[model samples]
Target: MSLPVNIDEYSRLVVLDDNELQAQNVAVSVRERLQRLRGIYAYWLQFPSKFDKEIVDYDMKKFKVGRAQAYDDLHLTQILMGNLQQASKEFMRWKINRDLEEDLRLARQRGDLRAAASIEKNRIMNNRTDKDDEPELEFDKIVPQQFEMTDDPTVIGIQKVPGLRDRIRKLEKKYGDTKIEDADYEEIKEEHDGNGTGS
Candidate 1:
């Protein structure tokens, strides 16, 4: 079966079997054009306040291209620079982090332990990205921890805990200096518990 194809589109393909030198010349011209375009792009990116006309003038003088070609190069450069990632803050941050990691790798390879440690420390200390060591926040655990909140003051100003409590004793030893009689502490504890009133 004959395939259906657009003859007009196929006619655009040229066979360059005889004109080899002309094909080579076209290839070289394209290469030079793209190189010039890339140079214009780099010049335009050097500063945010750089004017488009300045870039076009630089390209025209630098590459000896006409005003129209220089402006075309500037237009292409603007389109290339307009990419989402290239202009985003996150991309800049990621690029810096990647560069630091590469430096760290090279330092370690050369056995420069001090430089490697410094680079690694910089990567961690900078508040740029989410660190792996950061704990995943748990909503359920956000409830304030239940401690034995007491006001008797006996736990602190007592002689001995009899080890009745562990955490309370720790707090008392750390914060309290005065000590009370053990018998009186026990009586106060009973009164606070409402056991002494016998209501």
Candidate 2:
């Protein structure tokens, strides 16, 4: 589906405004346009040449760009996508910070000293100047609301730590006898190590 504005008009989004409200407005618009373009990109990937005119027309009518500008300029499209990705990351970061602040506020209000201390420490460490500006939270536990058993053989095999430990013991015995190939033994050992089954 095409956007209301031509894709070329959205070139302004490449240089977002300094004003928070203006930037948010542009980001919302750009997100919609990007979603539309993503659908077209997916379709083009599947059916290569079929939607060329449709995509071009959508870009021209909505973005106010010429045919050549709309159809051939992949670099511009990629840049817009990059901007969207950055905006999304920033938004998620902001949301996480906001949530943690809210949680800390609640903890303080409830006078939960232990929870407040841990959450405050996490917030401080997360916003520490020496480290990268990333959001981190310390949780006592993660209780999954739902769990499902996978039918996939690979997943089933990976989940079987006991079976893997037994195999590792067999591999170790073979390795001692010099009966197993070094490559095969190393590969199994790597898997065993990943499973945290042995030293």
TM-score of each prediction: 0.29, 0.27
Candidate 1 — worst ten consecutive residues by lDDT sum?
Answer: 9-18
The Cα RMSD in angstroms, rounded to one decimal, for candidate 1 relative to the true structure is 32.0
Candidate with top lDDT is 1
TM-score of candidate 2 versus the correct structure, residues matched by position: 0.27
Write down the worst ten-residue block by lDDT for model 2.
136-145
Which pairs of residues have clashing backbones in candidate 1?
A: none
Q: Write the per-residue lDDT of candidate 1 for residues 1-199, one digit (tens) a residue.
A: 1123233322232222325435655455545655675677666566545666687789989999866666655554554445232365456677878999899989989999999999977886664444565563232222333469875567788565465578878988987877765663343433344565643
Off by over 4 Å in 2: 1-82, 124-199
